[model samples]
Target: MGIIDINKVTYEYIRRDEDGNVEGITTAVNGVSLNVKAGEFIAILGHNGSGKSTLAKHINALLVPEEGSVIVDGMDTADEDKTLSIRQTAGMVFQNPDNQIIGQIVEEDVGFGPENMGVPTKEIWERVEESLRTVGMYEYRKKSPNKLSGGQKQRVSIASVIAMHPKCIVFDEPTAMLDPKGRREVIRAARALNDVENITIILITHYMEEAIYADRIFVMEEGSVVMQGTPETVFSQVDMLKSYRLDVPEVTELAWELKKAGVPIKFPILTREELKEELIRLGKR
Candidate 1:
């Protein structure tokens, strides 16, 4: 079994009235099943209300499944005794860094998770040091979070999560609030975490560009995984992705458009260099 295993999980959102009446119900996750091995990079893409976030919640036991189970490293999230362990094994980083960062300083913020976990004072600082360093934020450890940019703050937020020493990290649109440069910084940090620390990463994002680096991409729609494959394979189906209310990366889209316009190129060009190479090949032809 993988480090994270979700088996036929279903979750619903219940609406209620002021008088505690049954108003309505929305099924956010519908029989979703998938697995993630240790130290793998996975991306989940979906439009708003697609239930990707809801599924992410299950990884750390934020929400137990209504009809199925989420198991992390052999521990069932539904088991109350395993809740803390599940969270420690699969830490989450949210979209907005502002809401997540609460410390007066960067290092202080990063230490919160370990401190709460009852780690030794000496080791808490050690974890804070390593986590910030892993995210390339060690130099700014003593700086006030308010003085940092969006991307820097997000990195700190990520450091906070990693300080917990989670086996896996789930990022819920972690770059949604940043500018282009900030987005790049945050994404690069995430890649570093996977490459350097060998931590399992589950990124829930709408930005297709971010998904390009993932080992595999899973597209969600109506609370289920509609497509799952390598980035190249999934982005190759541009029209199908569009039908799901999502998009391919920019380079992929351009190549797709060129193909549609009668250019003798392949589908799902993932990078600028690949598109360039293909055009050069066509020119030579």
Candidate 2:
């Protein structure tokens, strides 16, 4: 089986009134099923309230499925005994780095996960060093997290997760709180982890540009996956994605407009480079 197997998982929560009375139930994840092979980069895309975040919670067992099962590395998330193992196997990096970083020093923050897991003192330091270096934060290891920028702190948060040596990392909109440059920094670190370390990455983001780098993209709408395919294939359906209140990469939308205007441009132009080459070819013809 793949490193993550989510089979027809369904999750819902009861909405309670201020008086502690049950109002109604809202189904956040509806019969969603997908698999993530080890060492692959998968992106989950959806606008807010589309259930993307809810689906992500299952990968590491933060939220158990009420109807189906989420099996991570062959262990079912529903099993209470396997919860810790599942968490160790799949680490999580949330949207806000401040919320995740809790140590006085950078290295201390990075080392917290392994230390809490009862790793030897020597190995915790080892992991801290390796993790900081991996994210290009080694030099800043002695500094406090409060002094770092949004991007640097996010990288530190990532370092904290990697120090645990998890097989997969779930980034739930890890770039949502950063500026453009900060967002770039976090994405670069994520790509490096997937390329260099071969760590499986499951990224949940609404940024269309970010999704282009994924091996496969899953588009969610109203608590279910509506589209799943290579980035090119999924982004090619401009109209469909629009209906889901989602946007494609900027270049893709531009190319779509050009195509509509009879420019004969190809569908799903992911990058400016591709669009330039397409225009150059058209000029030559």
RMSD of each: 1.0, 1.0
Q: What TM-score against the true fold does each predicted structure earn? A: 0.98, 0.98
| Tens digit per residue, CA lDDT, model 1, 53-148 | 999999999999999999999999989999999999999999999999999999999988999999999999999999999888999999999999
> How many residue pairs clash in all the candidates, one count each?
0, 0
lDDT: worst 10-residue window of model 2: 260-269
Give lDDT tens digits, candidate 2, residues 1-285: 999999999999899999999999889999999999999999999878989888989988889999999999999999999999999999999999999999999999998899989999999999999999999999999999999999999999999999999999999999999999999999999999999999999999989999899999999988999999999999999999999999999999999999999998777799999999999999999
Alpha-carbon deviation at 90 in model 2, angstroms:
0.5
Q: List the residue pairs that clash in candidate 1.
A: none
